[model samples]
Target: MSTPQPQTHQQAAPAPNWQSAPGTSYTSPIPITRTHLGHALTSEWTKIKSVRSTMWTLGVFLLLVVGIGLLVAANTDSNDYADVPYTIPAFFGLILGQICLITLGVLVVSSEYGTGMIRTTFTASPQRHRVLTAKLLIFFVVAFVVSAFAIGFVGLITSGMHGGASDNKWGGTVLMGALYVSLLGVLALAVGSMLRHSAGAITAMLGLVLVPAILPAFLMMSESLRTLGEKMTEYNAPNALAKIFELDSENGGGGSQLVLLVGVTAAAIAGAYALLERRDV
Candidate 1:
């Protein structure tokens, strides 16, 4: 035959079914449904430790808390300090430590954004809140470890630095400072989750965490600002929390300070989570 005749419409061969293949056409496996908080916590813990900044920031926190405390102790004369109501040097050290806390807090959350690994974290965790919570727990636990040694060593070494102005240190002020840093990490997490930029989040945190402390001095009505300043200072919970640590047991931070910090931290975290849910990942 010169050429095969074209099949008529009725005789046209049936089309092959491409839908069914040797291994059925890939149907994407359903994404894992639930995210376990414990799983997320463990994973986050690993992420924090692996990062270099975590180590460096942590090192600085310990160093300053100890070194400055020691130096302050060695230098200040008891005679001059006796008249001062507050232990200026120790107070100064506490304030300085907050600087380190801010960096440590920022890195804990902001690093994910800086490295673009947060997306991966979200991918694996899927539940944003769970991941965030895990992050908080992990940050706090590590902060606790760091704080234990950092606070204890600083406290003991700086006792002499107190220059006879006695402050037993609050029951948990040292721990509070650590928790504040950790919670600040949570605040950073919220901010970072929203901003997704390390520089911006860190800048925001500096303002959010530090400005209130400095603002008290700059206020126009110094005498009138006593109450207002007290209220505003709580915004910088770390520093306020640090003050609690600087006080003796006779005048510990008491409920008011603790309540103030808890209130502020709760508000910030709540606001952050709400924003996080509404914003694009």
Candidate 2:
């Protein structure tokens, strides 16, 4: 006969405080949530506002747009606005101010690539398209709002001093001008993303903006290209802005300008997205 088997005591398992969902083996102690575009937007907003370039560029932009506008308004008389909208003076200021916005837009994406911060950005947010979308949205909104405010403020002052014509659609015209400027900035952003370099993208955008306006002049010298040159002059950025502000005599071209800009921006954005996915950060 064998010695009495050693006795063992077994403890009962604790009861579950909460039942796990079907097929879930564990529950996370920390809250788990899916990320969305809103999160990307918040991140982009934080990055953009924290950067010094954004502040500096926008400050110079405001100064140029507002200061030049005031100077032009101060020098002109009520008779100057008799046929044009009170918002016309804003066009002159915005002509120079747009350069600042375009620079800022290029810097938004290119700066990250310059500093290797884009890798970290992508690591934190794996969705590349979302990041690009956020950049586009943030840059567009800031540019549009600032442009509109500066231009609108100038229009208000000029209108107050010179008395706008009763037929002038001051609000609509000013908004349209702001929209055109914002589109230019957005296009610059797309170029920045595609090129991934600040200087190159800035130069390219400057050329795009100024070249069309000037190249058309030279192209007009050749009888063969005079038609194409005329079309370029009609649709170039400066001409578009002038028309939007009612400074140009042309009518019904505003829609065409908007369509052209919108189409170009869209194509640039699409190309940027395609490159961003394929290129190494």
What is every candidate's alpha-carbon RMSD to the true fold?
Answer: 6.2, 5.5
Candidate 2 has what TM-score? 0.89
Q: Pick the candidate with the highest TM-score.
A: 2
1-281, model 2: which lDDT tens digit per residue?
A: 88999999999999877876788897579997899999999999999999999999999999998999999999999878767777777888899999999999999999999999999999989999999999999999999999999999998999888766445668887678888999999999999999999999999999999999999888999999999999999998888888787777566637789889999999999999999999889
Q: Please report the candidate that would top lDDT against the real structure.
A: 2
Tell me model 1's lDDT, rounded to 2 decimals: 0.64
- lDDT for 74 in candidate 1 is 75
Residue 97 shift from truth in candidate 1, angstroms: 2.3
Worst 10 residues of 2 by lDDT: 161-170
| Candidate 1 C-alpha lDDT tens digits along 133-154 | 7777787677767765665565
Pairs that clash in candidate 2: none
Residue 231 error, candidate 2, Å = 1.2
lDDT scores in order = 0.64, 0.90
Q: TM-score of the candidate numbered 1?
A: 0.70
What TM-score does each of the candidates earn? 0.70, 0.89
